[model samples]
Target: MELGVIDLVGGGGAMVAVNDSTRTLRRTRSIQLDHVWRALETGAWVTAGFRSATPWLSSITGESPSASSVTLRLAERIQQMPQVKATFADGVLAESALRQLTDLWSFDIAGEFARDERMLLGWALKFASGDLTMLLATWLLHNDPDAADKTAQEQFESRELHLSSLLDSMGRLDALLDPEGFNLVRAAIRHLS
Candidate 1:
């Protein structure tokens, strides 16, 4: 007599079943990622009459658009980094952590990441997401000492303020400010109001 899943609830093999289920989910995700990459490379979505892969993936997989978009982005990122893809395939990191790791990859730091991929992956396993982010920032500072200044300058350059009248006679204010500008505006509002 074979045991069913219901029978495994209070049985000794429950943990094994749970672990196997988790691994299966990870393996399925890995396979889906591979297929997504292949579809992008081969323009399968276009052939299927979709404008882009995100909608196609969402429709086909019954996942939300945002989730599919994230998966597509991660697939693209991991495709460029073979070692990271392998780690993900092996279920070394959970999806949230892997998303964080892939989000950190950029052309500016690709070479450095490739060189230290194993160490960083180990960190991903050990550190919380926020700690991993800080560690990566520190790593970036070591590689590029001017990164902080460059980022500040970029923020300053991109600042904007927009004022509009809403339909119900309310004013709408939209602003994007650098740290210094934000402080100045906050102080002015406090003084005036």
Candidate 2:
């Protein structure tokens, strides 16, 4: 039975229907990601007359370019992670959790992730998406402190303070600083001001 907006809002079982629809949508997205992975693996997208998978996915799924790009990248990352791939395929894992895992994933920490996959999946199931993201980030930082340090150093090296004049007599101050630098600058400015 199809649920129109009226039925969705007026029906007694509306919440149940909404919950079921959410599960169905999650499963459908999982299937789509699986197909995207297969297409990437087989070059089926090229044969289907598309230059690349992202555009083809966007065309078919009606997702924006950035969403399609993220989906494509997630598909590639999920392919390398057997346990994550399975959990995602089961549709038990939230998309946000999957994205968080993919975001913090690196080849250097693959083994650690693999070993901790079960524990992480448990947290994914128990925690909200934001909590899961923070948990995964903390896990990554603790497990791969060297990579975290390297990223901090890169950010420090790339830090910039830009002062530009606006149209009137106004000035703009733009800065990109790592955590320590930001704290130091903030302290100095607060003390002086």
Q: Which predicted model would earn the best lDDT?
A: 1
lDDT tens digits by residue: candidate 1, 1-193? 1212255456647766666677678778988899889889999999999987877997898765556777888888987677667877876566777887786676777888889888878887788888988997888788767768877876798576656686999986667689999999999999999
What are the per-residue Cα lDDT tens digits for candidate 2 across 1-193?
Answer: 4322244455647776675777677788878878888888999778889987767887788765556778887888887677777877766677888887776677888888888988887787778887887888789878997877776766677566656686998987666677998999999999999
Clashes of 1: 0
Against the reference, the lDDT scores of all candidates come to: 0.78, 0.77
The TM-score leader among the candidates is: 1
| Candidate 2, poorest ten consecutive residues by summed lDDT | 1-10
Which residue pairs in model 1 clash with each other? none
Please report, as a residue range, the 10-residue window in candidate 1 with the lowest summed lDDT. Answer: 1-10
lDDT of 1 at 25: 80
